[model samples]
Target: MSSTDTGARRGRPPQTPEQAEEVRARIVGATARVFTRVGSRGLSVAQIIEEAGLARPTFYRYFANAVEPLHAVLTASNAGLVGGITSALTGTDEPVELGIALIDAYLDWARGHGPMLRPLFAELHDPASPVSAYREAAFDDIRAAVRGTFTELGRPVPSPLDLDAALHVCEYVVYRISAEAGPGAQPDPETVAAARLTMIRVLLTTLGTRADVEYALEVPGLFPPPGDD
Candidate 1:
């Protein structure tokens, strides 16, 4: 078996939940940087160690190879976005408004984390070796949230064709917009902003929801705001 699969097969047990969480977080954060720097296929555990400031053995203590840590990073990114969507949905009675806010939140996250998102994009497009199952789960979660939002709005949950179509639209919109604005030969920020706004408007229209553009102006914080900032 490859070393990448060994950690799952045999590895030291966690002494405590906190320790496990810290190790997991470190692996993920490191993987994000490594993947951003080297792309998915080119990623190296040594690179992750350098980025994370952890020892070589410490890397193996958490993950078998770059792939596992990459998975952790993708999974964590999805979980964070899904959790934000859940919070936004539950915190408000108006699902329509929340839906708009969710789109903004997603775009904002992509803009801020384009480097991390790029490697997942590579994994998502990998044909011979599909290594993005974790990222796929994240997409599924987003779709589920979208479906639920439609139901909440008293609209029929989209037919499979429509749902698939809508998701593709969103995926493309987000990827292209972020790609243009991401580091290296960047476009004008105003142009990127215009494109993002156009995509958001198009997505909401296709999803059969009406919301104000001002909703985009108010990006929701990941945690509680201090005194309603």
Candidate 2:
């Protein structure tokens, strides 16, 4: 018997939840690919459906418009970054250590998702775009994580405006570095390393203190050196 026939004969096959999740993932993945290629302003529902190999009806069933899948992707990415930073910080309360961990987590997430994030960043400031909502939600999550870390460390929590500014600076630095280091940019590894170090130092200094910044610099490999892979 054919593999499909044999498998069907053996038992009932897939269920709705698993199949639905797989379909949703495919839609999101396709949306990311399309956004990376054409950007948000140029994106279309038809393009996404074609990329996902789904019917138009299927696309509508899962997402309301081109922006919804993009929102879902950003939401998942932000949740993952927040979860990682939160878990990594469970027992530590030192300001420098917390700052380093948070910066590391943020950079790692950016590196992994930089291409996927480019379009979202482009649309982030547009109040009419769904990506703006997701963008604000992401910053909120990061701010909450930072506040919690400061509380744990017995340090004064930054005002919401201050936290927002710091986080935006961190994000812009990461995004700029990632764009320069992308496929054909051919940036020197040392330059990337320096950028990372500078980012960590600035963030720690802004959110914590000069002493915390100095301490982070002294801890070797606290910021991963470039080309370390």
RMSD of each: 9.3, 6.0
Candidate 1: segments with Cα more than 4 A from true spot:
1-24, 91-96, 128-131, 182-188, 209-229
Best by TM-score: 2
lDDT of 2: 0.72
Residues 34-121, candidate 2: write the lDDT tens digits: 9888877778999998897677777777789998898777778778777877776664677776666777777667666756656656
Q: Compare the candidates by lDDT and give the number of the best one.
A: 2
TM-score of each: 0.70, 0.78
Off by over 4 Å in 2: 1-15, 182-189, 213-217, 220-229
- As a whole number from 0 to 100, the lDDT of residue 36 in candidate 1 is 77
Model 1 is weakest, by summed lDDT over 10 consecutive residues, at 2-11
lDDT per residue as tens, model 1, 86-145 = 666565555446555666676666666655665555566566433456556776887788
The per-residue C-alpha lDDT of model 2 at residue 188 equals 58
